[model samples]
Target: MKHFYKAMIGLDLTEMDDILIKKTIVYLDFLGIEKCYFVHVAKDLAVPDEILRNHPELLAPGDESIEALIKNKLREFDFPASMDIEVSAEEGSHPLDTFLRWAKIKDVDLIIMGRKEELAGTGSLAKGVATKAPCSVLLLQEKRPPGLPKKIMIPSDFSDHTDLIYDFGERISKEMGAELVPVHLYEVPQGYSKTGKTFEEFSEIMKKNAQDDFNRFIQKFNHNGLTCRFILNDGEGQGKALLEEAKLIEADMILLGSRGRTKSAAILLGSVAEKVVLANNILPMLIFKKKGETMGFFEALFKV
Candidate 1:
């Protein structure tokens, strides 16, 4: 079974850290995760000379203090004894760069981070990690409770990458005893009326075409006799349509594949994935990616 082995959780030393830790514990067994790295990055670890002179008791480095606090927080929870857990507090002006570096160094297979809605920090870190990380990323909604998903919604385009997305969805569903809901969004052409068809007629045609494609695509995968629901969306925006369907189905999580860009490209995630990440603030989303698929590009882009 394809499963995540090592996961890195980004901590900000806020209340969100507790939620993320609890969520990680809930998913460790389901994802088959063997190791975890709880990492916190500070903009600067240097203390001002003036402040240090006044407070001579503050002799320890900032990283040490931050690391100790994180360790104490972890002690509050009861993690599995068999899992290898590591805590790191590092100084980096650009946190996304630091996270990517650590993920590569640790050979991490998954990166889990909190997506703030009414929380303190903006969700840019989670978006950036989802866009550029070499491995998969799970963006947990701060407002949502952490637990096993009952139904995972996957947005499929019937591309070659859909196979990879379905593989992950199937593995997670089977292990966690959840249902798989695959959604396909189709759009009617701008000049559908030119084909002597009404707008409504053209819409139905598009939906039927999408259903045909989905039937063929799903024929190749073994769903383990699970009840898989197929949905068709013909809305204006693919990302928005997918989210609406997720809400209609009361999905617990949204899982989708990301066709990452090369080093020369301006963006990493495709347009729809990026849009969904930006607008979504309700459900936990897992962006699946082939591990180490972009290592060469990342090395060149970062000049490592």
Candidate 2:
């Protein structure tokens, strides 16, 4: 199905956070829809139990503090309320599980979440969800401060999932019409950058490779049909490199496949993809998940 109402459920509340929320609000507003839900799940036990017991109080007069606070947040964005504001509280050990459950129950077409840091490996949240979740995820990432969209940076490694954008990025990018910046960032070649910044020595080769990848993808489509800018970097983190390139190009958004190479190595790798989603800049983002590579045998049978 298609996602009509947009919702976000994270609260590290920063400039980058605001940017993503703001962008969602803008899109919903433009669509002339008012029933969007922006859920702020209180994962911690800090909220008093007394308040939890009186769950109805969220909408009660004088008890409307939280409700108003949430509405005020929406109002701040110039988005109108079409559906009654609903606040839910639940006790759960893992925030990801709680969110996934809620998303399933609500039949949410899109799930928006923010990451505080972009750590790699088994600990990443963004990577985890994008890989396993039942719905499409929009990870609002801000590397730089909130800014206008002069570019839209897409980080890819030519993997099946990342390049399998005929549906995800293609549909969204058409609506955005911002510069489709396709970036390929590689780690420095083993022998080079032995001591200093890894990008120092291998930058040129990476740039050339980026150009080749750009041409290859372009050839897959009609030339001069879509406007875009190409870039490359040899660096430590692909996420960080994408953010820097976003700022350099004054990008308005970032589109990427949620997890990286190790998507199936463990649980959802939403956290792995979190690096790009948690930027300080207010750029909107869309994260897609390609469950697995199409097996050659399966492809041949299907073609038959």
Candidate 3:
């Protein structure tokens, strides 16, 4: 596991003491993420510039009550190790700007934050941070059930870039003693919709295409075990349908690589992966970047 020693967490007041927040920090600690830099941006501070400098209504000279709040919340966490936890608050007129600037300065390897409800401006945050973050970001939700430790679910379309998540997910599953699941949505063409075939007939055809793609997707990972739970689904929109399938499978975590054929594939795919993250409802998404002609772990560790 890559060590996440210098870590930062972006937080809001509503996310205070969230179970996902605690579990994420604990998981990182288990994987050797020592010395966490916890940051919380206050939401409702509307002090004008004139009041901030001349009057200073909300805060005193070097007043740090908000900073103290971060510490107190961190103390509530059950950390596995004695890691240095620095608490700070970023002050700005806007919430997004304040948090983003702090993240840039810290230069942390991983950032953890709680997911808000779908309607309450959280989707906008996921879109902004996933595209613009200085490092890999992990999005956490409050009170997610601890599901299948030995079974992981991943959606793939087998592009050159989508293939990278296969290796990445394999490593994480190996560490946690879990199995990997690769899913493909079988959306038929618009003309096929008028056929009105029976589901059994439709399923047979979709399953055939899905299995062929799945086999090619796993060809590179020889050491990866061959047992996988295959799923076949058809829908109008890619994102909504996948979430429904994920619930049916009872997947522990949804993992996806950022690679798509459409616009802004690097940042926005609107695929199952992106929607799972934005929906921020049923599961937590672990996103991986699949770019460049890179070396594998064995090559990096032994050869280097």
Candidate 4:
């Protein structure tokens, strides 16, 4: 499978720092991304006349001094000039709107953002962008992984889209020379006692059932060049269990699939993926939609 070549990175100026700036460069370098754009949207791009007069630099030229500053910092990193990169700053009512619009205009294949702990909630801007983006999104919560990932974790619910999820997971694992761990999180029925079985017994039965499905899911796929394994976690919270498993295995990254906004209006980014991201997990996460998927409300309303 071909890798993501065109990339768009969303930047929140208030949270900018040396570490995240460096991580962005590292990701572009590792992915061999050919064209990249660093974008920032200012909610209050217009300054009061008095303040502007006092500080003319605030609206330097195109009111893009922040973008210019970021570009200068990136230049200090000394990445090869061959990588095509541009900086964009825009004034908009909402940051998410600006980002999604920029992504469409540029035809970006991958969207990258630094995971802000405060904005990791369901209604936060990060969730909006991830849910509405036209392409894949990589949420980075820490410094870049030292090299290509050694282990990529995929939390599966055995949904109908598991095939597409597995295919992309396999492709990424093979590219990174990493092992694929497909995990299923299960929970016993609420009224298991009605089945004439103890909670422990019922839990074990459900675990086995999930394991069987996971195994069959793996067997149906052709992962000749990749190492794939199944992990079954019987627990209450799927997101918590997945994170614990990833930490236990020292997984470098987590690959997940979104149900797409069109699937359901309430659950954006899927409940599990949202919890995992909002939990402030340390691993990088790549959440994407199925290929050829149609645009959702946000995408259609904000078309470039």
Which candidate ranks first by TM-score, i.e. highest? 1
Best by lDDT: 1
lDDT of each: 0.78, 0.52, 0.59, 0.69
Which pairs of residues clash in candidate 1, taking residues 3 or more apart in a chain or in different chains? none
For 203-290, candidate 4 gives per-residue lDDT tens digits of 7898778777766665766534433344444554667778888898888889888764354332246787777776644778888665
lDDT of 1 by residue, 61-108 (tens): 877656666676677887676788898887888988988899888988
Compared to the true structure, candidate 2 yields what TM-score? 0.62
Model 2, 29-92: lDDT tens digits are: 3333334555544356344455446554444443244444455566777554564445454446
Candidate 3 overall lDDT versus native: 0.59
lDDT of 4: 0.69
Which has the higher lDDT value, candidate number 1 or candidate number 4? Answer: 1
Per-model clash counts, in order, read 0, 22, 0, 0
Worst 10 residues of 1 by lDDT: 259-268
> TM-score for every candidate vs. truth?
0.87, 0.62, 0.74, 0.82
- Tell me how far the alpha carbon of residue 72 in candidate 1 is from the true structure, in angstroms, after superposition: 0.5
lDDT of 1: 0.78
lDDT of 2 at 71: 59
